[model samples]
Target: MRYGTLDWVPALDRPDLLAAPVTEALASWAQAAPDAVRQVLVAEIDPDQADTADMTATYDLPLEASANCVLVAGKRTGEERIAAAVVRATTRADVNSAVKKLLDVRKASFLPMDRAVADSQMEYGGITPIGLPAGYRVLLDTRTSAGPAIIGSGIRGSKILLPGEVLAELPGAEIVAGLATEIAA
Candidate 1:
């Protein structure tokens, strides 16, 4: 697959490009998912340019073609709740309202970076929804799951390319409308 100036290769052939959990998830998925749906593409990138702005500019990828996954948490009745919200780079997750309501919490906030990284076992700024912990809700903003887009590879050194339909079908993915709001230009 070709995305902008990058040549994307099958993810299965480049396990080093994926985080441990993502590789494990892909392995399990291969046994049950259709061959066509198993097509995940990846491209190498400079880790220093992994941030959205730098990535888009440096790699010649359009901003809209990228998605970001963020971790949010809240508490209700003394029980902790967590969710992963995937949204387009051009927008921001509506964690204060949509996510809080979905999680049935009175208030929601971003999970601390330390906790998010430790719990997901993914790099900060590179956490993708592909292999989130099973217990956490995976919320897919409508725009993001509809891919043919770029996303984190669970590592800063690479990016994953996949279709939206595939993302919507990810394990535990809950496709939600208005999960994200576009940012002002």
Candidate 2:
């Protein structure tokens, strides 16, 4: 759907949900990577019900929204590392192909909701790349560098705004091509 300026919704003015899991994650990320964290601007949204449409409308930005996928690997040796990948709303993270190869794990998959919630200490819908375990390998899609993007805040009702470049600062972030593709509207 083509949205006009009139269809745009205003950005939320404050990051008021301090107690939210996503907010907590953001705070943790801020302490770990102050420079990277500074680039993000947090906003509140309905984490449980929010999706690309709600995000696009609420942010009053173009439909070209940026998001990061949190991929966790479960190794045969019983180790897990959270990985972050940036992609546009129109594309899906190439987890099986790109992520699996990058992590050098025999198997890589999306973190189960319960595990993700526990690991990130954020609600299922609100997981973001920041504040994850220091060992976590964050991978950013080169496309994200094109502009500012929004990512989940480790809670369902909030998002963090920042330039895509900040993603590079994560411990093991790698920039790859064709990590995502546009989804039909």
Candidate 3:
């Protein structure tokens, strides 16, 4: 699966995608993370083609290597818990059963797109877990966290590639078994 030359530049140098906070967090995490997880890559992308299917076909990225991060919110006891779930593009997150239980909530639902964008301060199609607002739980499906993966760069015009372990090890990241289920063909 030759992903081709995405012009893998240091994440720190790509402020266009890796916002200041994200960059800062990555820098700090790298200091303590394993060598394989230290190097984060960012590549220029066309905003219109940033979606998983489009990016994979146009950029030569393997479908299996692409991971999607979805924001979910659950409420219980009059409190809201918002989390980001990272799953392979080939599957859908098991939000109702798995995530609801993990969140200790009666139900879980996708976060509203407008609120997600505004709260995360990231473009709708480019919300990565690396720079999410402080205290938001990050949940990585075991399949996604088991290897390297491609994800959004927090902006529409760029993409990021990093070891899945990095995502699984992000602050408050929880590797959930069966967090995602394979989508029917």
Candidate 4:
């Protein structure tokens, strides 16, 4: 199915009808990034989604990548604010060291599945940085903003393509550098 300039199976308008979980996610993303057109692609089970998939191998490709970050409003141990950082597949978000310091939180952790889904209003595998609450902080990796990149659309089965700048316009979105780095294989 094609919506706008991008082409993929299981259109975003009918995510409930799609059979693949990832496809549904991608469809939702397409709707979110209507301007990105033709940059997003829906593939089979991404290696990143597989527990056994090699991180090094997965990072080497040009796939739609989104990073999960925990944000806190204060410098307390129990305060946990979860946010998603979308970036290119080649890079990983600097959650523990950099993002943690930026949010001024005592600690930052990767959002667990249940909490991520609930907080972002996205399916387990389909959380994007867009369509989040206005107050929730969404930090975009520099690489993602440099060009057109694929990102999640609050679902798990699909991805959408759009210029990274558009993602910054989403509510509570901020652009930051050093959010991601390539892990040496």
Best by lDDT: 1
RMSD of each: 1.1, 4.9, 2.0, 6.1
Ranking, TM-score, top scorer first: 1, 3, 2, 4
Error of 1 at 127 (Å): 0.4
Query: In candidate 3, which residue ranges exceed 4 Å CA deviation?
Result: 34-37
Best by TM-score: 1
State which candidate, 2 or 3, has the greater lDDT.
Answer: 3
Q: Is candidate 3 or candidate 4 better by lDDT?
A: 3
For candidate 3, report its TM-score. 0.92
Per-residue lDDT, model 4, residue 155, is: 51
Runs of candidate 4 exceeding 4 Å displacement:
1-61, 64-79
Model 3 lDDT per residue over 31-89, tens place: 77746444677888889999999998988778898999999998999999999999999
Residue 73 error, candidate 4, Å: 9.3
Off by over 4 Å in 2: 1-37, 74-81
How would the candidate models be sorted by lDDT, starting from the highest?
1, 3, 2, 4
Clashes of each: 2, 6, 0, 14
User: What range of 10 consecutive residues in model 2 has the weakest lDDT sum?
Assistant: 1-10
- lDDT, candidate 4, equals 0.53
Candidate 1, residue 182: lDDT: 96
| Deviation of model 4 at 158, angstroms | 2.1
lDDT of 2 by residue, 32-110 (tens): 8876666666666656545767666765656565575665574645666457766777677877777777777777888
